[model samples]
Target: MKPSLQLKLSQHLTLTPQLQQSIRLLQLSTLELNQEIERFLLENPMLERDEPDGGEYASGPTPAAGSAQDGVNGSEQPSEQDNRDAAHEEQQGIDWSDTGSAPGASSTRDRDNDEEVDFQEFQPAETSLREHLDQQIALSQMCDRDRALARLVVEALDDDGYLHQTLEELLALVPAEHGVELEELEIALRQVQSLEPAGIAARSPQECLGLQLRAMPEDPVRKLALTIVEGHLELLAERNFARIKRLTGCDDDALRAAHALICSLDPHPGARHGSDDTRYVLPDVVVRKTRGRWTVGLNAEAMPRLRINQLYASILQQHRGQGGELPAQLQEARWLIKNVQQRFDTILRVAQAIVDQQRQFFDHGAVAMRPLTLREIADQLELHESTVSRVTTQKYMATPRGVFEFKYFFGSHVATDTGGAASSTAIRALIRQLVEAEDGKKPLSDAKIADLLGQQGIVVARRTIAKYRETMSIPPVSQRKTI
Candidate 1:
């Protein structure tokens, strides 16, 4: 064989600056995206938040396509030129409703307006549980060391107002403070528990319920209530109303009344104090199913409408003739603007491809999510596999079903008995349903679940079933056993 010169025509992907920018932007969380916008506004003299009554000068034709301001020192803006550019842009016309008038908007005018309202009006001062206890402790004339011990115990209480750790475990943390007798500590603990939210600072669910029941105004048949919470907690767990009547020495009528009272008691009194604050997840896409077709749209409201600064672009044009350092800065500015545009374009393309592929999922929910791979999507969109992965990584889409991370539509293929493949996500969902519907007295074990899956033609081992169950936070058969 002899070496011969050969010419081949093929396309390959290189990590271009534009692609890098797009990937970086695609993965930014909401907070990170806001920070990016702020950094851009600070560095670009031609970019400013449009202000109402700043007049026609405040917004300038929304800036032309490719215009972007060059930095003073490669990334810095010259103070004099920056001021002039900002003044010019301030005179530009814009519909205030477009950027302005949005709640929680980042604007100097908005900030100023917000500062005027008394914070106490709509926003109540939140008194944390620990702080509340501290206040009560401060008001008490307890000894210094006792106060310290009380604080430690209160801190140890979980979000549910139940102390998960044993008293001995807590004592170990502050052994030096063991000067206070365990009995005294117990007394202090009981006193703290008696404060507002009756069941708070309880050692267990039974104790929390008992505290609330003890706090109730009526005293008739109180002993029976206590007996039910203390001696017959198992009966309560199993919802054994008949057994509860026998155990509490109460007839059907009394048992019925006691059960109603028990339902009103707070099981996790401290949950509100240390519980998670409600977080709103805004989607990056909205998918709608109409006429048996799935439609997708980018959540435009969540995205910042960006454009190259026109005034800065003109200065860049002037700098090109002048030459020197200014020209370099102008080029840098152009690159930044181009990168921002490219980022949006790539994301839009990737998002559209995802919607097209997961149209079934959008129409019929996650169970209908077909087995999709990053390579397939990349090929469909004429992009590299890695590019597709990056674009889908942190991005999300909103569909008729709900908002889902773009990657949620993709999963590892589980080989089916019929030679076809199913999405692992779908299998996990099925496992969840099976476990939920399982008979409590005989909860399905991992092996039993695997057998069920086999019947569906999806061959998976017991360990694999266990792994999926663990991922769903379902406990093992022993732990799931009912009372």
Candidate 2:
């Protein structure tokens, strides 16, 4: 085949580094953005956080050079030489504030106040499951070999403290030359299981329950609980009270007591000692009802206040045209700042649009939520549907009804008798209400729930209702029915 160069005319879109950064920042959640800012602060010397009491320098638009007299204490206007310097600085990606305040120009008192405000008290670290087990093992009287084997077994156990691997599988892990006998491994397993949190090192759910049952005080109920765990687990799970009664020969009160005891046992005993790191969701935007109108605003605390490092910019200004890494770093810092600002601006716009569309939800809860879509918000905000999707993915809004993800407001529509569409979220809310108010002895079936919704104007299928019910972790009528 002969190769020939041909000029082909085509049109395509390309994202600049700044545009790519903007897209990335827009998609990131508040936590992720904060982490990204921290990373940039570390990598780029020309970027720094605008501290509070840095005055107007912390926020607002960069002032025009001609308006220098409007700054703090009527600062003197720059001369021709100073203007040249300022222009040079601007060219180097330095964004000077309108107030004309220099970077780190805040008084000592202001700096001290900022230090006090930014100080966060340290929290004590939580001990993990393995750490807790190791502490117990350390305190026990055991030889080196036994301790090592026990440590291996402890390490092999999963987060739930269940040994998913068989003894044979674990035995294979040991070196052949070590000649670790199965009896020694068994002893080690027993030693580890004998530690605190009664059900650790259990091979199965049955064994886990058995361990907890054995730890309980001796009682007739405990004995029956042991029997139930041993052989009648399936019957118990099915709530086949008749079969269980026939097999155990226990009366209503006795069986109930045994069941209650079994319920009290911890199926996952090691869960208590697991990692206790609680993740807190910070809303990116807040929606409020003001003077009979819905208003949306960004969460100030969630946003990282970023600014160009005036000190670095000044240094670059001093060495003009000495092209090196400084200019690249300066450009990068400028891009990051502009991208971050654009990200939040886009988020605020999208959030405001969402609040305006879903005002009914804020006023009357989830049931009042109207059917919304990404395309609707995207069209209203003049943004791409993918951009809207990214903005909604991890972003959250604090509303009168509570915090919710941006995506929570957008749901598929269900046709109604009134020729209007109701949000699937509204339908799910109605389902939840019906289930919550249902009589325990005769829980409402999915079909009954559908019928009730049909009567209320919203049309939904039984399968959809069941799916939403399961999504909300609600059980079926059969499982929900009380004795």
Candidate 3:
């Protein structure tokens, strides 16, 4: 085949640099956006935080649209009432204050508790599992041999606090010159196991449970729990309560009590002190109920207050285009500022739209959630479906119910008999309710749950119910069965 030059007219789509930046900013989580802004702030001298009322800059980045949300440009000043109203309007949310209150006028209980110490004042947040174990070992009155051996075992422990290495392995780990033996290592292991969290230094899950059960005060339930963990743990896990009952010679009530007691024990006690990889979330918007109407606004705290640097602005105004790269930097800064503002505005608009649609969910919980799709929200907000998708991804909203990703409100639908639809989330909620209310003696199977939903005129297949159940981390009917 021969190739020839052709000049047929063709149409193409191109994204401008500013539009690309807007799209990029919209997709980033609050933390990631702040990081991007920090880079821009460092690279571009003309771009700086606009702090007002002598306040520090917001740690998050949602872009400050005005001079400062709270501060006026130059001429007019807002009244105290106006300032209060503006602050409220900017951070519209339920008056759901944090549970932590300022130490109020001391009550008798408060006065009595005043003498006690608090964790914050005593311990730092960065303390790790290894460090915590080391501290406990230091305070312990073990002999030198025991201490050294215990420290060695502590070092070998997994983050979940299990000593995966057996006594022989641990003994082999010791220095030949130290004269450490298997018996001493065993004693040292016991010493570590007896620490604050009841299940540390265990060789296996069975031992872990046994250790926790032994720590409890002497009681029949505790005795039964110890019996179960010591031998019938596999039986308990398989939900073979009938066999357990026959073997233990315990009635339903006694077995139930024992099961409940065993359930209360922490399987992985050391996990709480493991490497803290907690990801902090800064919600882009907060949904609130004001005057009996659901409302939403930008979370001011999550948005970085950005404004053109006055010094840079004045320099550019006077120097005009003469200041080589300064003009370009100023232009770049302006683009960033505009894009950031647009990013946040888009987030707020999308979040408000979501809150309006999912208001039933807020009032009556997940069961009342209606089926939603990206197209529905896009059409309602007059935005492209892709734009809505970008807005929802990684964006979050703080509501009275809880903080949830923007995407959580959107899900596929299931048809109902009334020629309507039900959200997968709502169906999941219904499934959860049925399971929770189900008799442990004969837990509802996936097929049974589907039939139950069908009875309510909402059609859900058994496999779909099973899928939803698995997603929710619920066990199957066999695993869920109890005495």
lDDT of 3 at 85: 68
Kindly list the per-residue Cα lDDT of model 3 for residues 397-451, writing each as its tens digit: 9999999999899999999999999999999999999999999888899999999
- Candidate whose lDDT is highest: 3
User: In model 1, which regions exceed 4 Å deviation?
Assistant: 1-20, 46-121, 136-185, 203-213, 216-268, 275-279, 312-330, 436-443, 477-483
Where does candidate 2 stray beyond 4 Å?
Answer: 1-12, 55-125, 141-152, 165-188, 315-319, 323-332
Question: How high is the CA lDDT of each candidate model?
Answer: 0.71, 0.85, 0.85
lDDT of 2 by residue, 319-365 (tens): 88883777899889878877877888888999999988988888888
Candidate 2 clash pair list? none
Which is superior by lDDT, 2 or 3?
A: 3
Which pairs clash inside model 3? Answer: 62-303, 62-304
- When sorted by lDDT, best at the front, the candidate numbers are 3, 2, 1
Off by over 4 Å in 3: 1-12, 54-126, 139-141, 175-179, 290-293
TM accuracy, model 1: 0.66
